[model samples]
Target: MNFTVLVPARLASTRLPNKPLADIAGLPMIVRVAQRAAQSAASAVVVAADHADIVAACAAHGVRAVLTRGDHATGSDRLAEACALLGLDGADTVVNVQGDEPLIEPALIDACAALLQARGDCVMSTAAHAIDHPRELDNPNVVKVVLDAAGRALYFSRAPIPWWRDGRIASTAAALPSPAPLRHIGLYGYRAGFLRRFPALEAAPLERIESLEQLRVLWHGERIAVHVAAHAPGPGVDTPEDLERVRAIFAAV
Candidate 1:
């Protein structure tokens, strides 16, 4: 579908420094991520890094890599800069694959892209699924998204959305029907032109309060088409314990 996958890798992770280069099975996590994205049958796969070491590592594994400004506020900004550096065409679609998600399902990547292509009016698209656990609903780290019947996001929040007026899950469960409180997947797919235009959107109060960059788009009144993935999203590496868990998962796989 004339698309590319951009894997943004920052070397100095506050939680896990040099995380992109961290080993998974036999390859760096970022390399494995790029390979998985490549499985989407994307026209090209590129690793956008801020450090020379990351670039070298990507090259070592024969993955296309490019250097970008390290000061980007978020990976989306870094991806935009990478798109500019690589001279990516504005008409093409670029998938923002998280570098830490080495086990990301390729079908999810394809699904996100398919939504963007099938519904061209939305400049950006993402995936979501029902939050299976009540504990996850309260965890601020787990972003939540609510979508309209047309599959367009209504809001993204760190707070428990569709808040229970009764103040507890025990009561809330009885009030509502089955299936609810969609969890936002960190993955994104964007038009190359939209990626270039994204950085200009000013931060809104809602985004600042929640610390989610995606909210800026919603606050600005832009529609984000949502795709409901068939499978649960892959794990994201954030802490040392997460790395150990991921290592064990990979070992088992």
Candidate 2:
């Protein structure tokens, strides 16, 4: 079970500039993310940074960091460069952990990696949790995934999926049927070989419509194993308010 956790960190965030350097507790966000990833079953944890400052910040915490091209179209692209820089083999597994997820559970990381190993037919793997709240079912921000009988993702969308025929949406309320929806988590696990080729795959229309990079994999007729996590993942920092919330949570600890 040899695997590496690569945290792709970029300095320029439209919502929160220098987001990777944002402080969570006493450490930078990327440093905190690396620390959490290190706790997982991964053999190594590295921060794939797009800027020198991000690399320096990780170094300050004694974490391994690699500087990647600033113009990478996506985090996956940055990860491919980091893998090549590290000289990883094609069979090696790599987990793409976002730098903003300071509260990410180490178990979830291990689960995704393990799932990819178990599902030889799939090139990638990810995690999801059952959506308990009715509001989340309709919330476009919460990505939903429908899984096949084999636990492979059938489709991923911002819209409520597996739409209940019996249920109806009203002005004040919406009726959701039995069997709660699954909320797709952002974590991903990729084989080093497929990761390198991922960037070259043409962007699918569904991917652009849903703004989900994973959709491209499906559109290209690639299978993605989806593991239903035993527990829900912790919140990730995305905006100023999200940062403050994470800070408060860390301060309490």
Candidate 3:
């Protein structure tokens, strides 16, 4: 299966201003993300930048970058315009890799694309891993996904899902039950045609309440294939603290 990785980068960030240009090791964060995506099975890797500076940063590192409209409300919307600009066919697969995830694994990108290629009925695919800590299950920042019998996402939310009625909430990770909850990863894969139509889909109430864009697909009666990742995804840069943590990890390496 052929796939392309599109890194959607915006200049304005509420938590960390100009996050895409933030330094990681020596290279910019967006450049690092593109370098990792290039190692995957994807046929091409491109950065769909919201600003000319972001496009220039990617170009400096010899990565393909495209300037997209800055007014896009969501990453999917930005990628939709990118697909049109690239002139990608309807059947082609595209993976949406966030620009802030400098530590993202290339294999995870391939896995997500492969899931979509294998599942003809599903319009999109994403990954998740089993949560090992009780705190993570309760944390609203860590999204959780409940899967159906066929490994399709039943729902994605910030709240604790499949609430363990028999178990009591505890502070320690050891107190969690045998079958732990699954934490949803932020990566996604979609067909180029579906990606174009994504922006046209009406915003769903569940999506607005949960603040998860994927829920819009479920609300509109579309199937999303959920792949259980072999390992947890690396942390993404959302705040100054997150940037420091990632920088420290790179420095240690």
Candidate 4:
């Protein structure tokens, strides 16, 4: 079987409530996200969510959605359950797309899945983009990632990384380095077998300190393939202001 794309949507968010149902271009945000996932080369595109509201929204929009465990700590956990419900085999590749990204490109989805397929040694694959703006460098909300020459992730941190000992790192007040920094994109692709083992792995100190589950995989000595996306990932709708901003952007598309 070919790879499957799972769109993970949650109704609850600390910053903005009922984000999946938020309207963008007259359709629910999750609906628009699903539409984008459908453009992928995936054999199937399904929404994995915990709330009935999200499920109903997908149904109304003629999209496939499945209710998952409400207690899943992470979106990846939700995707695992979605795969189980769909009866995917261990070797099946699963692409996890965040539902808040209504404008996520289908090509990005295909690219991530293709990377995982090409690199059989890695169980997980994700993406990054060169951060050019000065504001994005200091924005703690925009997670940063550094990768090795082989395009494998070295670290994922919310703080500024690769401190320039002579330039930016030399002075506390020095301007942040705007070039070569890669902002981590939230989309992920994982083999079904590895995903089933994810929940059982003990949490690592770095993961707990940073509140990032992906860190646990790195800390456990596993390599995650990183793909450099050609374009910036569309801004995800996390706050009310962001909702308005995304709506305006989608309105023009």
Q: Highest lDDT: give the candidate number.
A: 3
Model 2 clash tally? 0
* lDDT for residue 92 in candidate 4, whole number 0-100: 83
What is the TM-score (0 to 1) of candidate 3? 0.97
Cα lDDT of all candidates, in order?
0.86, 0.91, 0.92, 0.86
Query: Stretches of candidate 2 above 4 Å error?
Result: 169-175
lDDT of 2 by residue, 32-133 (tens): 999999999999999999999999998888999999999998998999999999997577899999999999999999999999999899999999999877
**Residue 199 displacement (Å), model 4:** 0.9
Model 1: CA > 4 A from native: 170-177
Cα lDDT tens digits for candidate 4, 117-185:
888878899999987665676777778899988899999998778665666432234455645688899
> Candidate 4, which segments miss by more than 4 Å at Cα?
169-179
TM-score of candidate 2 on Cα atoms, chains taken together: 0.97
Poorest stretch of ten by lDDT in candidate 2: 168-177
TM-score of each: 0.94, 0.97, 0.97, 0.93
Q: What is the lDDT of residue 7 in candidate 1?
A: 95
- lDDT by residue for model 3 (1-253), tens: 6999999999999999999999999999999999999999999999999999999998888999999998999999999999999997587999999999999999999999999999998999999999888898889988999999999999999988878788765556467766778999999999899999999999999999999999999999999998898779888999999999999999999
